[model samples]
Each structure stands twice: as structure tokens, then as C-alpha cells.
Target chain A: MAEETSPRGPERRRGDALLRAIHEAALAELAEVGLGQLSMEGIARRAATAKTVLYRRWSTPHELLVDALHQAHPVEVPTPSADDLRTDLVAALKLLTDWMGTPAAGAVLAVMTERHRYPELAEALYSRVFDPRGGTFTSTVLRHYANAGTLDPRRLTPIVTQIGEALVFKLTLDLNRLPTDEELVAIVDEALLPALGFPLG
Target chain B: MAEETSPRGPERRRGDALLRAIHEAALAELAEVGLGQLSMEGIARRAATAKTVLYRRWSTPHELLVDALHQAHPVEVPTPSADDLRTDLVAALKLLTDWMGTPAAGAVLAVMTERHRYPELAEALYSRVFDPRGGTFTSTVLRHYANAGTLDPRRLTPIVTQIGEALVFKLTLDLNRLPTDEELVAIVDEALLPALGFPLG
Candidate 1:
């Protein structure tokens, strides 16, 4: 846990504060004007920062948008010690659904759609926002299951990653509904537990 | 088959021919001028149709785009058979991946994202395209599984729907990769088959 902290707490705190301000400004602008109308000048004004400051940090509006998005959707790492895999997965899935249903979720997704035209934004999005949050939690859960002898070691990462990805995908693309409690339980019983070689049914 | 043909033939043929001209023109415009630059006037000019014709059929660029998308992506409903669940799922997942990875997929996704601004367009897309293609396939597959005694009778439509939705969700939202063969197999082993009370793994 100590290693997770920055060596210079004051510097890190300052950076985090700046990032938070930028992120909140981005969100406000997006909600008010929509993604197509979001401008760096508007965000800067909302944040009470100079356009120079924004330009100094990010080369373009796209980069600034991506950075703000990354800050708003910081990576989430699941803590996997909830007694059993099912309980841990339910908690994790619930968190994911909550995030997806948030205002930030729509903002992030809008940026993703825009990523088709700007491929670099896709890489930034994947590396900064998605990979850290979803990717880390997925790996942590699979690793815990393997260590507990609940999951087959060989298939652990791929199975867990796909399940996590699928949950997020459903909310973003099709259905557009948050995962229900029953659906979450089904995922645990039918997918997560069995992937760990547990007899679920 | 006769009934299916009756409603879908002459009307469909005429509709398709008109749609084909519009689609080809749209595609050419998209390639030449890009999505933001696309207009009904340009599409009509390229297709040799009046702008009024385009407007009569579709009210907005998004509507025309959706129609163009449906024309490009004809739904393929899988015939339910008593085949092994693993085999059936793999075939189905393959079709999904192929469609998502096609050239038109990005364009269609763009329209879906734009639909957020137009709720009516979003609803039309949901009923006309998304439901009939992905949603219908999911129900059909689940039904086959239930009848064959491969799925748990307790597992209802929503749960089965989640499983299907997740597969596409993962590809479009998170991993940006299609599910591999192993993943298709694992989904059945862990999620679908077990939820339905079928023994997998």
C-alpha cells in the first residue's frame, strides 16, 4: 500500500487537484453543451484556468478531453477478499454497473465514439481509463481465484477479463441497462464460479 | 418461407434498390468528404435522386444513416437445432464478431452514438436494428437450449439476454477484440449452460 503512494505527497496532491479541476470542468461542459460542442476554451473558463495552462499540459482539445476523461474515470482495482468468489464478483460487478450508469460513463463513451476519427485518443483511453480500472480488477479477481484453488490457473486471466469486459460492454452497447442483482448472481454462478472449476449449478 | 417472402420480396426489392443507391452514395460521400460533411443534398446528387426523396424517406442524416446501416447489415437469425450448446454458441458468437468487425460497424456505431442527441432515432434503432438482429438471435438460442434440456428452466429471458449482450459488449466496449474460440467455449461452460442447470466443465 505504501508503494502505491507517491514519494512526494505534496507534488502528487497538487497534480491530483489540477487533474480534478480539469475533469470537473470537462464534465460540466459536456453535460451542458454536449460532446460535439465541448471546447477547450469552455473547459478552461469553467475550471478557472487559462487556455495557456490547458495548452501547456495538453497539445490539443482532443488530448485535453482524453486527459480529463482519464482523470474522471480513474482505474479501479478490486479488493478480492470477500470470503468467496461469488461475493467478491457481485460487489465488483455492482461497482462496474454503477460507474457505467453515471454521467461520467456517457462522457467517456462519447469520447470513445469520437476515437474512431482520432485513433490516438483510443490508445489514450485504453491505456489511461479502461485498462487501469477494468483491467486491474479483472486480473486481481482471477489471480485470487487461482491462488485459492477455485479457478483453473491456465484459463484464469482470459475468462475473468472476458467476463468483466462483457459486463461493461452490455451497458455501453446493447441492452443499455445496468446489471440486475439476479443477473449478477447468474454471472457469478454460471460464469465466474465455473471458470474457476467450481460446480455452480 | 412463403409468408416471409410475401412481405419481404417486391416491397423489399424496391426498397433495397432505392436503399442501395442511397447507401452507395452515402458511402462514397463518407469516404470522399467524411461523416461530418455528409448531407442529403450530396447523397441525392450522388444517387441521382431528389433531395425530397431522401427527406421523404428519412427526416435527418441520422435517420438516413440508420436506414443505410440496416441495408448494409441484413439480420441473420440462426436456425435453432438440437446441436451441442458449445457448437451452437461458437457459431453464433462468430457471426456477431464478424458483423462488429465489418467496415459498416463503425459507421453504424457512430449513428448510435449520435442518437443520444435524438431520442427518437435511438428508439428506432433499438427496435428496428438492434432488437431484431442481436435480441432476436439471443432469444432464439436460449429457447433452443431450454427445449433441449441443456439450459436451466429457471434461467429466464433477461439472464440469457445478458449472456448474449455481454459477448458483444466486451468486444465493442472493453477489449476491442472479438472473443476467441476458447472464450466462446468458456462462456457456455461457465455462464450459459450452468445458469440453465446444464453441467459444463
Candidate 2:
């Protein structure tokens, strides 16, 4: 812990601030060098911290990455005002899109794209980051609505839970851009809502 | 064209046979070296043909790669038996999964994954491969059913057309394997069917 204290005196990063910087650095390093080349040395260098400091917290780059991803993963707040399923679902996906704009999202993509080459990393990401946070993007909102007796729980199947994130990923991959507000609404109207037992007539 | 005659006597690749070989080689080469490093030299070497032979049919690797993808892209066949939408939709996604198992699929993914770095190649993929083939996997089936008056044409929105492929991609990414037949059926029943106005009671 001696090297944890920066030589730069008053500008030294510590506590939650230091953890956040380290997490950000890990993600940035991953984006720059990819999963194969990600190392504690590189992350430490990027964070302007000593390898000893990283070693104190995480045994390997994989562990540090899992921590970073979990720390950065956004927990969706399902605000079901007046029992509004559509608005809440849209807001959940909006949280997802907003997260997609962050550096952490890019890092997550890098890990996922190379998941086959590194199975343990992908597994750790799910257990540490995604699953603990309530599965996919719109899943929390769906569950909230279901619990409120507004939406059918049976309709909240695995396929239904994944619809929002799946479509978001598909649109992003196809368009090479985040889906627009209008497009998000269309996903809600055309896809998500109907799957929840609300047919389009 | 003189060098088009193989030095290996009776094993000479020429005409359509030669063209097919060249296309396959281009896709294989792209898979091996990726888009940035793809070259006529590598493709010709892999195809066991001269660079001159390659240049005779196509000017550059991009042109040759596009041709390869177009040649390999699968056309969905919708057999609407007794006006059945479920069977046709399932078969369409089956075609998609089958295509996903091919080398061409890998080559297409390679291009798409790095689409930003190689925008022109990505654009060529859509124009020459996807759009020309019928937009997406389930779209053709949806249209066929729509024309037969079995499905509501208005229900065939972009979001609806994408549900099958999107769910497939999502499942594959999350599970690190292609969706099983059971999973595909789930997608159709729980997501696609409902979205197309066939909600489960």
C-alpha cells in the first residue's frame, strides 16, 4: 500500500476516486489493446499507478476487468408510474443506449466479441456484472411490471426478457449507430409490447 | 488469361469452376488475414492461381470479396402449407442458422465487426449481399405470407422483420453458441408470432 500514495502530493487519487480511475483505465486499456493483450502492466501504466497497487486489489487483468465491468454496469430503475409498462420499458432501454455511449460499453463489446477465445472472462462478466444486475437491459422493467400485476409473468420468458437488448444490438450492428428515440419506440410498439400478450390488432 | 491454365495439367481451374474457387479463396483469405490485410496476392496464392488471373476478373480484393459474399448468400424458400405462418417462419430461421454455420458467414461477420474501420466494405456487403438477397432471413417469409393474405402486411415492420435474426444473434452472443432448435422455436412462438398478431392466450 506504500506505492498507493502518489508522489504528486495533493493531486493523489485515493478511496472511491482511485477505484473509479483504475476501473476507467482498465476499460480504456482493453479498448486500445483488445482482450488478448490486456495486462495489469498496461492498465497500471494507463492509470498512472504502480503494478503493486493493482496487485493489491486484483490478482490478474481478468479479475480487474470483471470488477471494472461490474462497477460500470448500470442498474435499470423501473419507474412504473401509474402502472405504465411502455414508458418504463422505453426508459430501461434508454438507460441501455446511454450506457452504450460510454467507454465501458466498448470494453464489454471487446470481451464479448472475443468470448470464445476467452471463455472464463465472458463467464465472469455474466456472473459478476450482468446477471447480478438483473439480466438483460429491459428485464428489470418487465419484471417490475409483472410483479405489479399489469403484465403477465408467463410472458416474461427468457426470449421476451431478451427482446429489447437483442433488438438494440441488432439495430446497432446493422445501422452502425445507436437506435433513435423513434426507433426505440417502434421496438416497444412493434416488438416488446406484443410479446407481452398485447397484440397489434 | 494465359496463366489461367493451371500448371498442374488436368487439375486446371478455369471458367466458372475457376471463378468459384477464386470466390472461396477470397472469403478464406479474408477470414485468415482480415479486411485490412486482405490482398489479391493472398487470395490468388490460396486459390492456386496467378495474381494476373485474379486481376482479369476483378480489379481489387474488395470487389472480389463482395462477389464471394453475394455468391454465398442464401435465399430463403417459404413453403406456406395450408397457410401456416409458424412452420414457414421457423424454417426461415433454420435457413439463417444453417447459413451462420458456413465460412461465408464468418467472412461476413469479420467485415461487419470492423465495419467502421472499413465503411466501404461494409456498404458493399449490404448492397451486394444482404439487400440484394432479400434484406434479412425472415423478411422474405413474412412477405410471402403477407401476399398470401395470411399475415397482416402492416405487421411487417422493420422491427418485426428483425426479431428472428436479432434474437438469434443475442442468444449466440450471450451463450457463446448458436441457438438450439428449441431456442429458435421459443423465439418464434414467444416473440415473432406474438409480434405478428398471434399472441399466446
Candidate 3:
């Protein structure tokens, strides 16, 4: 355990610190060069480490990228405060907006946007990062409410679960900007909650 | 009027016929070369026409491409069959699916997917094509129902009008396939109708 420590200083990161730096470097490299041009040597160079160090942890840049995205994937925490489905759903989408502003999000977008050219990498992304991280933002929150008996389990169909994220994407595509807080609230009130069989006034 | 006739047995096109040929060639050319590489020379070559003929009507490839998308854009016909909201909504989304199968859809996708790279083209698409064509597949149908005093106009907010198209785009992005008829029906029954104030059994 003592050997794991960097005796010199913070200049030489070790253990979890080293791993985090490598992950961040992978994402940054992906953003700069895109998925088609991602290379282990490039990532190692960006991380200021040796290619041997990266190969010790991951076989290929694809493996390292998936791990980077998985580490950066957000997990929703459904609040138990008064069983507020609206607040929870909004907060979950807020997490998505926050994540969208990250370097990992750009990496993920590059992979998805050019998925046809990199099918294997795209497949790894879904299997390793998205699926293992509860599929989507509102999905975890919806499942939590369903478990709490606050929402009808049957109402949480695939179409219903996809509403929030879908509209967010559509709105973004149309407006060329992230949805404001009020727009997010309108999404919950107008589309998502209604599909969940909530009474609309 | 005599001069307008094609004397060489359809070899020399003119007027609306020639205009349509140019439009189709533009869409095909956009799909082949993408937005950045689209040009009058390529479109005219594909259409077997002179560049001067194209210049007479349109200023640039962007202008011609937008016009092609507009011309090829589907207009919804809301059938007045027994005031059936479910059937009409499904039919509307079906129009979207059909449009998706066309070359124009690929052209549109190329522009949208690379909107940041060519912001003016994207802007022209919305203002000239999408907005002028009722905005979305279900938007026209929603307005029809609202006008017929069948659906509450209050229910046809921007979010509500967007639900059908939003889900369609989202499903296509996730599944990488067009939504089948059964899936479209599910969208109507599970999401659209419920939001439009129809009771779910």
C-alpha cells in the first residue's frame, strides 16, 4: 500500500488519481480527434503517461473510452421527500442538461453521430455505459416512483419513459439551444405527467 | 405557348418539368456529397442541364435544396372519418415515416446533423421548409381536431403538438429503424391520446 503512494509530489498522480486523469484524457482526445481517430498513444500522450501504462489497464482505445464514459455516466437519485414526482423528474432531466455540458457528452455525441462508421464502438457504449446506468435520466426517477406506488407501473411503458429525453432532444434540435428551466417544467406538465395518467388542470 | 413544348421527345425539359428535375437532382446531390460539397455544377450535371438554367431560377445550391425539401414535404390530410382521433394521429405519423423513406429526408437529416457546421442552411430549412409545411407531421392533425371542436384547443400546446414527432425522432435515433405501425399505434394510445385528455383503460 505504501508503494502505491507518490512519494515525490502531486506532479506524479497515483492510483485513483492516475486512473481519473487517464479517463479524462481519453474523453478530451475523443473530442479533439473524434471517434474515428482516437488512439491509445494519443490518449497516453494527452494524459502525460506512457502507452505501456494505458495498455496495462486497457487493451485498446475503445475499451478505455467505454470505461471513461461509464465513469462519467450520471446516476439518478430519486428523492423521498414528500413523494414529489414532478420535482424528481425535473431534477433528473436537470442532471441530463448538466451532463450535456461535459466533455464526456461531446465524446458520446461524436460516437453516436458517427455510429454507422464505428458500429462496434457504438455497441460498446450502450452496453457498457448507458444500459448499466439505468438507460436514461427520467427512467430511474420513473422506476423509483413506480416502486413507491406513486405512479402506475403499467404507465411506465417504453414510449412513456422516452418522453422527457425525446422532447429535450427535439427542442434542442429545433431551437439550437438547451431547454430553459421553464421549458423543462412545461415538458413535465404538458407531456410526461399526462402520459403517466396524472390529472392535468 | 408553342415554344414551351419539348420537341425532342422529353429530351429537352422546360418550365415545371425542368424545375422538378433540378429539385430532385439537388436532393440526390446533397445526399451524395453532403451540404458542404453541394454545388450547382454537381446538381446540374446530375440533372443533365446547364448551370445557366439553374442560375435563372435559383441563386445557389442552398436555395435550390431548400426548395426541393419544401416541394417534397408531405402535407397531412386529416380524414374526417367518425371523429377518430387515434386513426388520424397514426396516419399523421405514418406520413412522417413515409417522408423518412424519401431522399429528401436524408438531405434534411444531413443538414440537421451538421447544423452547427452550416448554420445558414439549417436556418433556411426551418424557415423555408419545415415552418411553411405546418412544422411537423402531427401539427396539422392536432389543429384539425382542435378546429373540429373534437379536441380541446387548450390541449394543443407546443409541447403537446411536439409529442408525436418528438417520440418518432427519439425512437428512430435509439432503434436506428423506423417505428412500425404497431409502435405508432402504441404511441397514440399510450402517449398522445392520454395527453390529449382521452382516458386510458
Candidate 4:
């Protein structure tokens, strides 16, 4: 699989292939043995690569696992052209629910729970994964609503963010179930809309 | 401290003393070292007892820590004789805020998060610590309000429970700040009351 003859040259191709192999191997290991059981030695063995190669790129298992998670759930910036706040929020929430409801994401959360025992790992995960994805989208949608004069501009961010965070918490920690369509609707109608100063009859 | 010392026997006092020592030591260790570092051996050492003594009553660290939590935040059954549902709920929320705001209670929550990794421990915490205590008061307040024609009766429990859970999550996980008195009032008035069909101005 080495692209030695490619126009981009052998070095770039070799690096790309190595990263891909390591990432896939890490994911497969995560699925089979869980995060607590994941190790660089195990991942290198699974990928048919030496442990030195794995350590050269990533210093710790936490860093490697985080990179794998990023690959699995690539960040998508939400454009606020959906006409209304509720529609935009529903779309954003759907995106969040879909990503979090997956088995891989569940494993990620399990790892995160364990990661909390290590504060540095917890901080890394929060900054790299949690905040940028969900937090950004929620804030952007609320800002758009506030700009449009529909929402109370002052409390918009905190309110919408709280609702979104609550939903995520419910899925990950409380109910351990996916958010149903009905729940999505209730959240938007009963919780988010009111907080945004919209009247929902 | 054994309470087994009856008027005719000395056995009762010995049992009571042992239990007291164990309980006090557990609390002290939790406060000083936190949940992550809590261990049965540590508790035994602090209590001036042997590890075998702790193991005789509790099989695992999780069980001992959970029991300690239960003893700390025991279920409080509310007597809702107040005419206004708002007043009763406000009183209950105040109590909840005070309990959750304390450092000791926060330490108990630190242990609860660890319980998430162990499902059985999570279930036990939910049933013993969560549901019986605050859950009962919340349900009673909602039922009383609905019956008195102050709010809608259908699905009141779930709605109120969600709001309460959200508040707790906000304090413990997200914002990491206790809900202010004003914020608590706003939550009850804006979210809980309106969702239960109470008209909010």
C-alpha cells in the first residue's frame, strides 16, 4: 500500500497510511477490549506495526484515543440559514443525537467517565471534543436567533446551551437511551423555545 | 459504641461503637482524600480498626462508599400541607440547594460519578440516594398542585423530575456553580410551572 510512485512522493503517502492504520486499529481495539484495556502495545500489534511507531506520533493512550474519536466524529460547522430558531435548533440537536447515539460514541463517553479520574485527560477531551462540537453549534444558533430579534439576546446562549447539555447528559448519564423524536420536539418546544422568549402554544 | 449493650448484656454497646467508628472514618476519609482515593483499608486505618472488620460488613469499596453516602443524604419525605404549590416547591428547592451546595454533599456526588462506571452501584445510588429522597418531594408537590387545579395533572412527575435533574446536572457537571435563590425561583416559575400548565406572566 506504500505510494512510492505517487506524484506527492513516498514520504507523505507512507505517513498517511501509517496514521490510518493506527487509527483503525485503535478503534477496533476500543470496540473489542474497551478503553480501560487499550494500550499502545496492543494497538501496534493489531495494526502489525512496531510499538516505536505508535509512540513516535502519540505520547499517551489518551492522545491516541482522542485522535481516533476526532476522526470518527469530524466537526461540522452549522450555517444559520434555516429561517427560524426552532428549525435550526432541531437540526443541530438531531446532529448531536445521531453522533452520540452510536456505539462508538458510547465507548467514547465511557472512556471519558474513566478519563475524569485523570484531570488532564478530562481537560483535553473537553477542549478538543466536547466543547467545540456541541457547545459551538448551540451558541451559534442562539446567536442567530438573538440577532433576528426573536430571542432575548442576553439569556439566549445560556438557556439554549443548558437545554442541549441537559439532553446530552440524559443520553450519556441519566437514561442511557437515545433521544426519541418526541423528546426532540418536547425539548425544542417546551424548553428551548420558551427560554428563547418564543411563545409556544 | 456497640448499641448491643442491653440492660442485662454488654454486647449492644460494642456493636454500636464499631458501627459509629466505621461510619465516622468513612466520612473523614471521603472529605480529606475524595472518592477516587477512598478505600476500605484507608477507612479501617482511620477508624482504628482492621480491614477485616470493614470487609465483614461490606464486601466492596463501592458498597461501603454507597452506604456512607446514604447515611449522609438520607431520604427526606416532605409534608406538603401548604395551600400554594409554588410555596411548597420553593421550600423544597431551597432545601435541595442547601444540601447540594455543601462541600460534604459535593464529595458524595464525586463518589456518585465513580458509580457510573459500575452499573450496579449506579442503580443502587439511584434507588437508595436519589429516588427516595428528592424524588418523593418533587412528585408530591407536583401531584398536590395538579389536584388543586393549579397545574395540569398529566405527566407532571416526569416533567418536574427532568427539570430537577437538569438543575442538579447544571450544578454538579456543567456550570459547577450552585443555583442561586433567584435562579431557582425562575426555574420553578418559568420551566416547571409552565410545563405543568401553570400560566406564567
For model 3, how does the per-residue alpha-carbon lDDT over A1-201 read when each residue is reduced to its tens digit?
Answer: 474456565666689999999999999987776565689999999998999999998998999999998888774444545579999888888877777778888788767765655689899998887775445678888888899898889998999999999898888777777888998998999889989998598
Model 1: per-residue Cα lDDT over A111-132, one tens digit each: 6656555568678777876765
- lDDT per residue as tens, model 2, B3-121: 55464567765699989999999888876665656899999999989999989888889889999988887755555454678887888888888877788987887678667656898
Candidate maximizing TM-score: 2
Please provide, for model 4 over B1-201, each residue's C-alpha lDDT reduced to its tens digit, 9 standing for 90 to 100.
Answer: 664336464332258677876776787786666555678988989987889888989998778867777776754555577787777876777776777655446555555544544568678777877776444555667766677777656546343357655755554455446677777676666665655555456
Docking class of 2: acceptable
DockQ of each: 0.23, 0.44, 0.32, 0.15
Going through the candidates in order, the fraction of native interface contacts each one reproduces equals 0.27, 0.73, 0.53, 0.08
Candidate 4 chain B minimal-lDDT segment of 10 residues: B4-13
Model 3, CA-based lDDT: 0.83
Give RMSD to native, each candidate. 8.8, 6.2, 7.3, 6.9
TM-score of each: 0.73, 0.75, 0.73, 0.71
Query: Candidate 3, residue B85: CA error in Å?
Result: 1.6
**Top model number, DockQ:** 2
- Residue A2 lDDT, candidate 4, scale 0-100: 82
**Superposition error at B67 for model 3 (Å):** 6.0
Q: Which residue pairs of candidate 3 clash?
A: none
